[model samples]
Target: MSEPFYITTAISYPNGKPHIGHAYESIATDAIARFQRMAGRDVFFQTGTDEHGLKMAQTARDRGITPVALAEEMSGHFQTMANELNISCDRFIRTSEPAHHAASQALWKAMEANGDLYLDRYEGWYSVRDEAFYDEKELVEGENGEKLSPQGTPVTWTAEESWFFKLSEYQDRLLALYNEQPDFIRPESRRNEVMRFVEGGLADLSISRTSFDWGVKVPDSDGHVMYVWVDALTNYLTGLGYPEDTEAFRKYWPADFHIIGKDIVRFHAVYWPAFLMSAGISLPKHVFGHGFLLNRGEKMSKSLGNVADPLELAERFGVDQLRYFLLSEVTFGNDGSYSAEAIVARCNADLANSFGNLAQRTLSFIAKNLEGRLPSRAAVQPVDTELLETVRNATAIELPRLMNDLAISQAIESWIKAVFACNQYIDAQAPWTLRKTDPERMEAVLGTLFIAIRDLAIAIQPVVPTAAGKLLDILGMGADQRDLAALTAKGWYEELGNSGFTLAAPTPIFPRLEVPAED
Candidate 1:
């Protein structure tokens, strides 16, 4: 049986529509899921709306609608965003679902049974917008002298009867977990942040909220409800049918990775592991805190009027183009800035000029000069052997290690290097000019180029699925020959054609994005 690779994006808050930041996480997670599936792994990728929070109830009240109704409508927008971006999550869970509520309650009970839960009076600073708590030291004075969360969101002091989890008791254990598994939290910066925060000592977290009625109810108590994070984070387990579907729970629990925004690093890296440890459940193998997406170097915000709609961006550019730019343009652990010009520049330069053009030029050469058939190879020349050897080594060794390390931008960059190498080979050999002088050599040149293109497309399929598939289609790769598993099993240079594969009449896989005229 293939190994299971479970990954998830932090469920989006449905208080509003999806933005480029939300789209960014979904696209990256989708890429990993696609890559894992292509590698023949059992992948359960999940993403969806995080319903049942103070924000949802507030948004509902302001709109004069029921919370459930509001969640239904707004969650649709996120689902639409996922669809627009071609996200491939296996389950799009909502915390409002009965199964999720059951799972959250069961997990709470397990923690309670472990002696981690106790009834207590909760008094602290809380940010409804962030759905998070702030210590006295963590709050900052805003421009108008109002107290705010460190994230600049307003906070209200709340005192209520709540259920507390003995997170302070797990402080040492949490530190040990981080020490034992250094990659448990990713991007050295975020890991350091988590370590510092945990080293400062831990507080017993208020796991249930008594003042809100819109969250998951405590398993036995009628007055208190599970804290929003507890309810929301449990959605990951709920997607796998925890505590009920024992088989699935046993199979996919302890997600391989939870891809999330940097702002929430503390929750996932610190609080989540503590909760899991208390429940005697396995911890997630890794949590990656990716940086924020800014618009032309400014943080995107509605009040600032700088927020870019992801749907508009996808429609204006192409979906795969946007996906490529998101993963390729930005270093996965670092922040990225996007603008119309930046998006257009990357789409055209990387997609059209580099990857797309190389595929077109070599494939067109084969189509026009070789009668739409892959030419039979001659004896491998020294140059052909060197290039083929390099390309083979790239597919077999370099790409998989990069993917395993989750170095997405570097992996795509490496694949593009091979694409450039093939282009360089064509330019040096001048396959076009060779057609007249050395027709036999021309066949071998195009054959070598075809093999390189096949491997490049297969390697990059996870990032640029649609374009890669089109390239493969035009290369006359059959359905069975499409997957990369076979390519890996049989070395890259081994499948040199004999009778020749027929080509599809090519359309430009990527047309350059035209810059919109200025007003």
Candidate 2:
């Protein structure tokens, strides 16, 4: 059996329509999941909406609808965005699902049984937008002398009857976990920030609230619902049938990664681990808090009128193109800026001019001149051997190493370098010039490119699945042969040649994309 690798994106809060940020996270997570699957892991990837929260309640009230109704409607948009973006998640969990409620309550009961839960009157600063409580010390004064959360969001003083969790008691244990597993929180920067925050000292957390009823209700406690984050975080376990002894839970628990935005690192790194310790559940392996996406180097906001709808961006620029640009341009743990110009320039240079042009010219030449027949083993040359080795090193070795470390952009950089090498090889070989003067040598050159293109297409399949699949289809590669293992396998080329699977005239997979006109 393959080793199990489980990963999840922070379930999106569906209080509003999906934006570019949401799409970026989903795309990045999906790419990583695909890479793991291709590398022979049993990967279970989950993403969806966190539908229960005060924001949802307030939005529903303003719109004159029940919270459930609003959740259902808004959650559909996120699901649609995931589908349209070709996110290959195993489950799209919703917090409002009955199974999720049971799981949340089970967790609550477990923590309570551990003496971690207590009833209390809570008074503190809360950011309804963030759905989180903040220490008075953590709050900063705004320009107008108003109080703001650390994220610069406005905070309101909130006092209510609530249930509290003994977060303060687990501070030492949480710090010990961080010390034992240095990579429990990723990117070093986020890890350092989390450590500093925990080192400062932790207070008991407010885990249940009486101010709202649009959440999982506290078991045996009337009129109080579980705090939004409490239920929200539980969506991870709920999808795996937590509270039940299921095979999935047994196999895939202690998730390998919880891919989230940088802003929520504290919630996942601190509060979440403490909750799990209280409930006697093993913690996840890693929490990767990825950086935010900026719009043209500036923060996106409604007031700035730069909040791009992800679906529209997908429609304007093909899904794979958008995926490629984000993963290649963004340094994974660092913030990335995107604009129409940037997307078009990057995709066109890498996809259209480099890899796409290489595939189009080589395959088209063979299809037309060689009547779709693959070059036989007798046509092999020394140059062919050298180029193939270069391609193999990049696709099978270096790329995998970088991806395994979660250095996504670096992985892509390695793949593109291989593509550039192929381009240079093709240029130097001058196969078109040799077509007439040395026709047999021409066959060897085209055949070499055929093999190189196959490796390139397979290696990049995680990031640009559609385009890569299209090229692989035209190359007549088997589904079983499009994996990392397949790249290093010998005689596949000779096997293909002997099988008489003649290539047809190829269609261009990566067409040039034009920037959309600004409105």
Candidate 3:
């Protein structure tokens, strides 16, 4: 049997609409999921919205809507964003859904049974803005000398009666688990931070709030509601058919990866696993906390008026262009900036000029010169062997490595390098010139180019889906005929070993951008 792979992105907070940061996380996870599917894993990918929170209540009040109505509307926005971004989530699970609520309640029952949950008055510094409690020592003075919470979220001290989780009781066990499974948290840096925080000693966590009625209610509690993170985190299992149905749970539980942003690493790496263990549930295989996307050296924030509307950016630049920009701009686990200049430059350099240009030039030549049919080859030259090896080597080595590590940029760089080599071979062979002087030699050259272009489209389909699909269409390759798994599973030194190109009226996959002159 093939290995099973389950992946999820942290559900977005439904307090507001989607932004570039949300798109960045979803797209990154989607790309990895798609790659794993192509590599022949039985893959399950989940993404959704966190609809139950104090922030949801405030947003509802401001909009003059009930919290449930507001959550429904905000959840719709998240769905639209995922669709526009081409995020291929297998299941979009909302925390407010019946299945999710049931799963969460079941887990709560389990924890209760295990003597891990109890009712107590929580009187500490709580930040509704952050949906988190802050210790006095964690506060620091902002540039304006106002005290800022650990995440720089401004906070006010409040006392409330709430239920608490016995996080302090499991510190040593959590540390021991971390020691036994070092790969549980990712990027090494994030893991070190989580361990240090856990080792410093943990306090019992406030697990329910009485300040808002917009969240899940604690069983038999009059005013208190379950904490949003605790409720929200359970959706991973809910989406896998937990509690009521165990088939999907049996098949895909213990998620292979939980892909999330650096901002929420602690919650995912620490709180989540502890919650599962206390409830007698198995932990996820890995938690990879990636870096943030910054704008002008500041974290993108709505209050700062610096939110990058992904839809607006998609309107200005195409969706495929936006997808390419996000993956290519940064190493998978590092923070990076977003600039229009950078996006346009990468579009022109990598997509339009490099990969797209190779297809257009090759196909256009065949359409005009060889009556739009793939050239039949009867011989192999040293150059053909070299170029084919480049294509095969790229798919075999770099593609799997990137997908395994969730390093989208590195995988794309490896594929683009092959396309660059193919373009260079086209120039060196001078297929256009040979068409007139040595027609047979030109046929062989075009045949080789067709083979490279076919492999390029199949190899790159995971990263830029639409663009790669269009490339396949231009080559007259049937949409469903490409075998991506076979491509990646082969040996590096071996060629794709077949050509199935029939040229059609070709159009540019990604058109070049022309800068407007200063007025």
Candidate 4:
């Protein structure tokens, strides 16, 4: 049996509606989880909304609604979007849930027991927008010549009685832990940045907010609420039934990956791990911080009026199209730009023209010439053997890199390259011309092409799931395999190496997108 694998996307803050950024993270994480499942792993994937925060509180007040009401409505929308995108999350944890509250409080109690929790009077610059306290050196000058938070939001001086986590005490220990296990933070660059930050200096972090009552209440403290990050990060454990439930926690704790955006790299890589260490819990294996989607040169943001409404994009084109565009256009862990024109171009070139057109033509030829049945493989040609060998070899090379390094976009590209090679093989062999001259050779060629297409569909499913599934259905391989694991050089292919496939009438997998001519 394959080993157990656990992954999670950052729990989104329910301060606003879902945008392309949220969709991007979800789709990327979903692909990884789906791929792991295909690899025969017991995968636990979790995602949900961060409903306890000052932003959610203010949004509630602005709309004359209770926080619970607003969070419920927005959380439902997030769920709807995830379902629409076919997100295979095992748990959708909400921090406001009783289970999550208990788990978070339990973590606080654990830290207290560990002597990491202490009472402190906080007097510093706080950014309400970020719900974070910033040091003077970390602040930058605004256009108005005032100090601003790292997020560019203005910071104000605040004084409050709060509980603090003695983050400074663990700087050397955290560094030692990271050095001991270098793979604890992923992608090298993120790891280096985190190490630099830790080495520069560490400060105690305020863990409670006395100014707001919009979060997990500090246990035994009536007037203060737990910090939003502290509350939000606990969802990972809460989803696993932590604290009260020992068996479940043991089963899924110490997640394999935490997929977060670049903006929160520091939070996930440094603060989160430190918190875990303080509580004597094992840290996660990897904190993979992927970059954001850019609209032109600027970050996509709601206030900037540049955020893409996920549902709108899905409605205008299609969910699979959007999914394909996001995953294929951008290299994972790198920032990428998105434009409608680029989306249309990729759809037309890669999808409609390349893979889709090849499928249509191959099936059409078989249907018209061979009575809609898979041609019998009576004899093998050099080209047929070469094609199958290329597939087996490429699968061997790419699958490990994709699985171990999480190189998702490269994995899809590798399979697409194989598909293009199959197309070229067919065009050069001229199976249609050979059909009359040498029917047996033609059958061999078609047989080889059919199996190649089958493998292609299976290999590409994790990236473009819906389209690949449709193509596999048309090819009559849908029932035989659900993933690339089915395409191995096993007894089935070798035993029937001379057999032919009964082809089906193919439909366009991805129809070409056309733009209107300007008036």
Assess every candidate by TM-score: 0.96, 0.99, 0.95, 0.95
Clashing pairs in 4: 373-502, 373-503, 374-501, 374-502, 374-503, 375-500, 377-499, 377-500
Worst 10 residues of 4 by lDDT: 489-498
Error of 1 at 234 (Å): 0.6
Writing each residue's lDDT as its tens digit, candidate 4 over 86-117 gives: 78899988888988889899999999999998
Assess each prediction's global lDDT (C-alpha) against the native.
0.86, 0.94, 0.84, 0.83
Worst 10 residues of 1 by lDDT: 491-500
Number of the top-ranking candidate, with lDDT as the measure: 2
What are the per-residue Cα lDDT tens digits for candidate 3 across 366-484? 88888786675655589987998899789767777876887788888898889889989999999889888988888888888887887888888777889888787766556444556
Give model 4's clash tally.
Answer: 8
Whole-structure CA lDDT of model 3: 0.84
Q: Give the TM-score of candidate 3.
A: 0.95
> What ranking of all candidate models by TM-score puts the best one first?
2, 1, 4, 3
**Which model, 1 or 4, shows the larger lDDT?**
1
For model 2, state the Cα shift of residue 218 in Å: 0.1
